[model samples]
Target: MSFAERYGPWAVIAGASEGTGREFARQIAAQGLNCILIARREGPLKELAEQIRAESGVECVTASVDLAKPDAAEQIAAVAGDREVGLYVNNAGADPNGKRFLDNDLQNWVDLAQRNVMTTLKTAYLFAGPMRARGRGGVLLVNSGACYGGSSFMATYSASKAFDLCFAEGLWAELRNHGVDVLSLVLGQTDTPAYRTLLAEKGLPLPTNWASPVEVAKVGLAQLPHGPVYNWGQTNDVAGYAPNSPDQRRARVLMIEQHSRSTFGDD
Candidate 1:
């Protein structure tokens, strides 16, 4: 059976151990899309794979590799080989502590770039080759909404996502007429395990009306066709870039950065 036929379509997601990445896997499972779940920790990924297979009744494969390591892309690509990949979700990333950009350790930036930028870029590029040749495929890059302007504390994370936004949209335009769909999700606050930890550490209240993983996943996946650039919200995350209000885009980012840094020492 063909890829789109066997699993009904297949999606490979990086950073599948937790948060949005895990949700993406479950969402793909709901679509009957066979999934290859990748992450640094094998335990969580394997557990997630089993849960997806059992709950959604779709096949799930797990790969544990630090996508930041050299040659990691090749290793991931080899396993992903010709599975007739129809969808690729580049969701792996790390948030450097809220620190002044220059004051932080240099290695943190390198590590973030390797995971947030290089890994995702290489995987997407490798996957797109088959997707393009097959004339059918979809790609979704999970990014922070901070890319609109970014934050002082979260500088590196925000800039890294900016790369994903550009890459996805550019590819979307190229593939639009060719049958491949490339999309980006500029995600807002979500209810994940990390939120509580961050909140407790910072001694701050949780953001009101934050989204859940399932909610974000449903909207993000549905909006893939509208083509690159979507904001996850109460419903579909298909909203394009925001209006040009002075602070609607940039002000909040700055405020959040200031607050986040003040609460926890920037890493």
Candidate 2:
């Protein structure tokens, strides 16, 4: 089947206002799927929706709900209405406060968990169930290189992203035979608006060789069927116990999964 036939009718993209999320909206729409755009910023979402409609000639829906809130999934569903959503992209879970764990407010970490962990899990449960029944759909969880290991100032962020990575891997195993694709798109130093803003706040200049959001989005969609995980750049491919090479990680997951199935009899 074609891309649209396999994962289309409609695709819901959280964090759809800008950067990689915006590019995902564009790329997915270009491939013939209508889009439901969700972000806390209403203006950007509406602008993107209009652009997608005009450019791709596909229906566009917009929702301005904070993904950190408990009712985020409900708001998204209400916006989506009864559309048979075939793809769900969880991309709203960026770490806003790039400070030491103790330097940040407790509430900030909690809200981060709500956005990155709780909301992601909720939306997966919401959208993936129907997709599995339909037998052809996808879930792309945008993740970070920090997930590979802990960092000095990225404690909670790293931990939450690790959760996302493992969750996607497990989901990939469960849904692979059911015709639902799941990917953890792990990124490193991408040139996103959010990254620029964070750098500006810290009085730092842009890096010379950051990954492009457009290319990242393109590769992510192309690699959806081959996941478990996609480590976007060599920044993640290191010589250590926790190597972040996509092929290595994929092999490890498959190996462990085979062992589990053999031991537990695929119950």
Please report the candidate that would top TM-score against the real structure.
2
Please report, as a residue range, the 10-residue window in candidate 1 with the lowest summed lDDT: 243-252
lDDT per residue as tens, model 1, 38-71: 8889999999998998898988888888877867
Q: Quote the positional error of residue 139 for candidate 2 in Å.
A: 0.4
| TM-scores of the models, in the order given | 0.82, 0.94
Q: lDDT for model 1, on a 0 to 1 scale?
A: 0.74
Estimate, for each residue in 1-267, the C-alpha lDDT of model 2 and write its tens digit: 999999999999999999999999999999999999999999999999999989999999888999989888888888888999999998888886989999989999999988999899989999999999999999999999888899888999999999999999989988998999999998888888889999999999899988998998998998899888887764334433346566777778889988998778873
* Clashing pairs for predicted structure model 1, backbone only: 98-266
Error of 1 at 215 (Å): 0.4
Each candidate: what lDDT? 0.74, 0.90
Clash count per candidate: 1, 0
Q: Which regions of candidate 2 are displaced past 4 Å?
A: 234-244, 262-264
Candidate 1 TM-score, C-alpha based: 0.82
**For every candidate structure, what is the RMSD over all alpha carbons to the true structure, in angstroms?**
10.1, 2.0
